[model samples]
Target: MTFENTLHFAQQLDRNDPLRSFRDRFLIPQAGGKELIYFCGNSLGLQPKAAREALDRELTVWQHLAVEGWFMRPDQAEDTPWLSIHKRCKDPLAQIVGALPSEVVPMNNLTVNMHLMLTSFYRPAGQRTKILTIGGDFPSDQYALETHIQARGMNPADVLVEIFPREGESAWRGEDICNAIDTHRDTLALVLMSGLHYYTGQVFDMAAIARKALQAGVPVGFDLAHAIGNIPLWLHDWQVDFAFWCSYKYLNSGPGGVSGVFIHQKHHNANLPRLAGWWGYDEDSRFAMTKGFVPMAGADGWQLSTPTVLAMAVHHAALQITAEAGMDALRRKSEQLTAYLEFVLRNSGYPLEIMTPADPAGRGCQLSLLVHQDGKRLFNRLVEQGIIGDWREPDCIRLAPTPLYNTFEEVWHVGQILLKFRT
Candidate 1:
């Protein structure tokens, strides 16, 4: 599997790609009538071409049926009542996240779902009052943990234990993380970590970490925002206590699309504390106008409101695409595509450092570059050239060669553009 930094080579690779046809399923962005090399799927995936049609179908149902859309069966074959449209997403999303269909539910946005899950998992009592998480997590997660602890009358500094990579390293070692869990086993109430770190684009050893935490008598969870569709996961097999992810990124739902949650079957009937709503009540008695709050089983029990039909419509369109392509195939292409990008960058003679781990097992599609100087200028240059990648604060530029839409030729072109910056 030798890679040559030439357009001909890239073109040949694209021609040979089994998943190349997937690129046509998405509507790539254009600037001045030319398609831009879109490598930002880690942030927002390209819209699937089928999204509009799916959305239109939902809109038509609303137009013709009005209020009755909630109950009226559109057809015997389809059976898509608006009241339960969210249920259609469960199987597809379950496939993506490797959970039982009953264990996964497509619901609210990421941060909101995080708060809801925290309510159930982050119960501090006795000496076990601290929440363990990794440093440099997405800011929203940090804020959520801090505020939740404060709301419970605990100081963040006292209850939060954040682990960081040893000095000069960009990613945390698996052993270090496991040892930290052991070190703080006595006071830890919950272990919350990102499945794939947002900033450095490093894939944490989630299974190992989860095992360690569980062994220490702690419940573990993950924020899978960057991990969901971009990587393969076995949440149920991994025995993860809980997890949540947004759909807009590699899942290819539109911006602010619906999020998904996973709660293991072991906890389905535990009667854990939750912030309840009518939508979460047992389905059979939901419309009976009962006074008591009886939650549904599994992840549905965590729902706080009625599903957003339009957003779920968009999500369904995207998850359908993911289901068609399959996660194993997507992951295979991602490794090769990202490895090619790394080869191109290394050979480009730029004084840049790749922050992501070299091992394909330790990352998804993203490659973060630590530019020696003038990082912003270099990022702006790429943008000016219609090479869209993301830039994080100090000196890193993130590019994700999303397997579903991005091609080998585009990865090669990015290298050419990056070399231009070196001059």
Candidate 2:
């Protein structure tokens, strides 16, 4: 599809877009009585207009029912029981991540879930005591891996095989990642990688990476904090061992919303050790409060505490929208939105380098730009213009035009701003 650099053309594309109306459902940000072109979905998504109502309903339930809200009555079939509030997210979360309902459980934040997954999967035995992962990964993931290794009484420098890109390259090459997995396969106890790189917006080949590690007899898992909702996933089909993600960003579930995990049903009954909590005890025997710890079947067994109902309420509302839009539709729109953004930026004559992959399939909605001279000043000018993209340190002006809320016109207008700003 050829793109034209005109407001009329952008507007025409928006008018014909199937997902256009979905934008109206969100509350857009405004500055000085003018709407800002929000390209910061990679950081935080705009609030869903329905989020308020979702919260209010849950608050009312707490007011009216108090402790009774935890139990479901035979009378009101529609009641969202607090005992299983997070369960409402399972099917939608499953559909989003391409996993079976039994394989998904929406619970704690991303880092907490990552810690839990690390506890179960990062079993260091004999000579195979290392974890293979990407270098310059998201800070939280880096910290989690570093601290987890330290907690297990191993020096991170010795136990972590961090695969970094070549000096001139901005992204990790597929073969490079695969080779790294093979290089340390014997000493590697786990292959922990981000499904999509947060800094460069590079989407890793999860299928190939997972296959390589598993074939070499090493366990693998992904941190999908930047991948989920922005791109389509098939964790079940891909046979990914386990994965976790936050519901902010592309998922649009308010700030620090609940996170979820996918554990293949094959491991549901496996005697994998976990950091146990009362909430994860077998449901039937949970109230019995027995002496021994018998975990609930599947991913729910990893849950460490009571569900965050208020946060999950927002997540439930937000996920309902994603489920309704469908991942295939979202992916299509995401590709187009990103491609159009790239086309506009490339043609704008802006002195910036795209740090993300050129191939549409190798990225999600984000396109990170490494600006040239006066980079910080240029970013500030755009912010003053109410063009809301974020500036990451070192050198990155990330613009992520979300499919659910952003439009082609906004992308075109951003190009216009850059073009005029130079003149």
Misplaced by over 4 Å in model 1 are 75-79
Full-model lDDT, candidate 2: 0.91
Q: How much does each candidate deviate from the true structure in C-alpha RMSD?
A: 1.0, 1.2
Write one digit per residue (lDDT tens) for candidate 1, span 1-423: 999999999999899899999899999899999999999999998999989988888888889888888888566528478788888899888999999998999999999999999999999999999999999899999999999999999999999999999998998899999999999999999999899999999999999999998899999999999999999999999999999999999999999999989999899989798889999889888999879899888888888788888888889989999988999999999999999999999988888999999999999999999997999998999999999999998999999999999999999998898787777
Reference-based lDDT, each prediction:
0.92, 0.91
Best by lDDT: 1
Return the lDDT, model 1, position 368: 94
- Give candidate 1's whole-model lDDT: 0.92
Question: Each model's TM-score?
Answer: 0.98, 0.98
Q: Point out where model 2 deviates above 4 Å.
A: 73-77
lDDT of 2 by residue, 245-343 (tens): 999999999999989999988889899988999999888879997798999888988888988888989999999998999999989988998999999
Task: Please list all clashing residue pairs in model 1, or write none if there are none.
Answer: none
Candidate 2, residue 108: how far the Cα is off, in Å = 0.9
For candidate 1, what is the TM-score? 0.98
